[model samples]
Target chain A: MRRGPWLWAAALAVYAFLYLPLAIVVVYSFNDSRLNAEWVGFTLHWYDVLIHDEEMLLAAGNSLFIAFVSAFVATLLGTMAGMAIHRYDLKLLNFMALTPVAMPEILLGVSLLLFFIQVLNLTLGMLSIVLAHITFSIGFVAVIVRARLAGMDDSLFEAARDLGASPWETFRYVTFPLILPAVIAGGLMAFTLSIDDFVITFFTAGVGVQTLPLRIYSMIKIAVTPEVNAVSTLLMLLTLSMIVLASRFAPDVLKGKT
Target chain B: MSGPPFVFLLLFFVAPSVIMVLASFRYPGEFGGLAPLFADTQTLHGLTVETYEFFFSDIIYGYVFLKSIFVALATTLICLLLAYPLALLIARSPKKSRDLMVLLVVLPFASNFLVRVYAWMIILGPQAAFSQAVNGVLALFGMEPVHLLFSPFAVLVGMVYVHLPFMVLPLYTNLEKHDPALLDAAQDLGANVWHRFWRVTFPLSLPGIFSGSALVFIPVLGMFAIPDILGGTGDMLIGNLIKEQFLGTRDWPFGSTLSIMLTVTVLLIVWLTTRLAGRGRHYA
Candidate 1:
């Protein structure tokens, strides 16, 4: 069979559709004029403004803090759940654990907000956002880790037990070491997801508590400035780097054909 | 062993949702807040089915819900059509290029989502190069310049643009590993290109197709941002209705009803897909 020009044309056009907007954002970030409509000349004025904007910086810092903390907690719980699923026969547990993922983010966000403000009487702020993030993130981590565990050799754990090792010792020596890469990879992914979550964060966040995504949404609602473009370009770079690092540790997760 | 994770999920994820369900039954309270569901059994009197009735009886809600389904289905179909070719190209490419293409597909996830939506706003505007070029060609033909920005067309464009990668990633993953030898074998059996694709490539890619469609459809059904920024008032979907209920009207009961409706719809779709995919596997 011969390859045709039409296929290549369609593929190229799709690629252009995917990349052109990001390219435009990047290009306009350097535009001399404040308006994204016209390009006067090349300049770094927006980047300068972004750097000097304290609110954006604080929002970025808050996002990083939330991502790290939530990812850490999610990794812990997710790994425990993954190990449990691998070791135990808890069909109901597995179903319940993954339901958060199958549900919509808005539903989960509103649920958490109500539970926080009504039932628990907790304040809605950074803590609520972090809790919500961790709640959703744990499901993702468990799924990834469970995939890794399914591929792992059962003989390693059996052999350790046959060598007169205790259950905890066998897991500590063999299972933990083997699954560490997946745990770290899942954590990185959690961090990635948490950093940019907007809808969930919006519902859970209190007055004055802002993540970068929330801040960007507010800024865009008001106006789409060049500074927003600069911030977005930087956020893109940060996300790409994090994903690359995660992929390095868990290529299977990224290439997840299964 | 599973106790801790189970407890965490039951407490945070499961319980809050139960609360939402209960909250949906309570009457709209002061300032549009939900009446207290737990004050006493006497408060049970406040629980009513009016919110659910509101959704069911209102033709407006029915219209938006239908529209959301339509948009989601259209987005999924468009993504499937567009992404299949791109995924096929990537799968057939050299290893380096394949990896790069996959990276390109995933790269957009890192950028701020609002910024990406905002980018579409810029690109669709009258002053933007894409519109300018189209209008320039239109002028040569003595045609009027079309106002595409803030239209349903722009909304469709934004939805497809944002979700294209979701379709492509899964398709590429499945297609890349498919043995080209099967295609060769089909070709040797007197099959034309279309015949070979229909009999071989398309059947083998069912899993990817289902998975990709599920990924694209579920989110697009509940998506508010694209319609909010790119669409006019007519393009309002269930997502906007739910958001307005919660944030604008402070009507938690109505919002919860919409949320539950959406959740049930999403679950049904997931179940249907898995069943279909399971059938596909048995055939394979």
Candidate 2:
């Protein structure tokens, strides 16, 4: 059977559709002209402007801080949940682990907003954002860790136990090392999701606490700017690098066979 | 650690959602806000279908609901068509190339979704590069530049661009697990490529396709940002409508009711898909 030209053309078109807008953003970031239409010449003016922009800098800092702390907390909780579900024979525990993923972001955001506002009477800020982020991020981590744990050989733990290790010691000496890469990968993914998230953050974040996405959304609402193009380009590069590194370092774990 | 997480979920996840549902039942009184539930029998009278009726009876609301579904369905279908070949290509490529392709595909998702959508606005807007290019091409054909932004076309383009990866990754995973030798065996039996694909490959890959469709369709149904930016003033999706009720109109009860309706619809689709997939192993 002949391989048709249509198939290859279709694939190319799909790839172009998926990537062209992003490529345009990156290209325009370097365009000397402020307008997205005309490319006068190449310059680093946008990057220079971005570096001097304090608000963008602050938002970037907050985003990084949130991602790092939230990812760490979610990883710890998720690891425990994954271990409990996989190691123990509790069916209900497994169901509980899966519930968060099933819920909509809008619902989750609204509820968290209400909970913080009405019940706790706590002022919304980075703290509430981090807390809300961790809620969903943990579910993602648990999913990845559970997949890794399932594929792992149980005999490794058995061997550690036979060597006179306590359960904690066994996990530390045997299980933890095996799943460490996956845990890290999961953590990276969680961080990415947390930072990329908008709907939830839109609700949970306070009036003063504007993440980069929130800033971009507001700016877009006003009017599109070349500065936004520049910022998005930088963000796209950072996120793409993280995802590529994560995928490269932890290949088999994400493949769902551990 | 064991019991505490469960309690946390119950309090944070479960309880809040329950409150939102309960809040939907309370009526806004003369004071123009959510009134006390017990104080109003007129509001809580067993089951009041007034909210549902109001949503359904209004022609504009009904039109928006149908349009949202159509847009979502179109986006899902486009994603499916694009994803299948890409998945197959990734599956067949060398390991390094395959991994690179997968990374390339997944990497876009890491950037803020709002930013990505904003990027699309630049690309599809009146003065966008694509629009200019199209105009240039049209000038060659002695035609004029056409308005593209603030149209359904723009919304669909943004939707498909944003959600394509969600469709691709799942399909790739399922396709990656396919046995190459099975195809070879089919070839040996004198089955043509199309026949082999229809008889073997397509059936095995249906589960991924169904899942991909569900993933793409459900979220796009409630998508707020893309429609708001790309769609015309007349285009109001259910998500935008809900947003108006909650924030613009300050009608929490009506907003909550719409929320419940949307949530229920999503849950039903998920349930039906999973159930059908379970029964049909080809799809599953």
> Cα miss at A255, model 2 (Å)?
4.7
Candidate 1 chain B: worst 10 consecutive residues by lDDT? Answer: B37-46
For model 1, what share of native contacts is present? Answer: 0.60
TM per prediction: 0.94, 0.91
- Which digits, one per residue and each the tens of the lDDT, describe model 1 over residues B90-141? 8888777767777777777778777778899889888778899999999999
Which CAPRI level is candidate 1? medium
lDDT of 1 at B100: 72
DockQ of 1: 0.63
User: DockQ of every model listed?
Assistant: 0.63, 0.47
Least accurate stretch of 10 residues (summed lDDT) in model 2 chain A?
A249-258
Model 1 residue pairs with clashes: none
- Please provide, for model 2 over B1-284, each residue's C-alpha lDDT reduced to its tens digit, 9 standing for 90 to 100: 45655565666677777877865776654444355555655545343556767777878776877788888889999899888887788787777777777766766676678777877777777776788888889989999778778888888988898889889888988888888899889999999978988998888888888888887998898887788888888777888887777656767667777788788878888898888777658342
Strongest candidate by TM-score: 1
Tens digit of per-residue lDDT, candidate 1, span A113-201: 87998799998888999999999888788888888889988998999999999999988899889998889999999999999898889
Count backbone clashes in candidate 2.
0
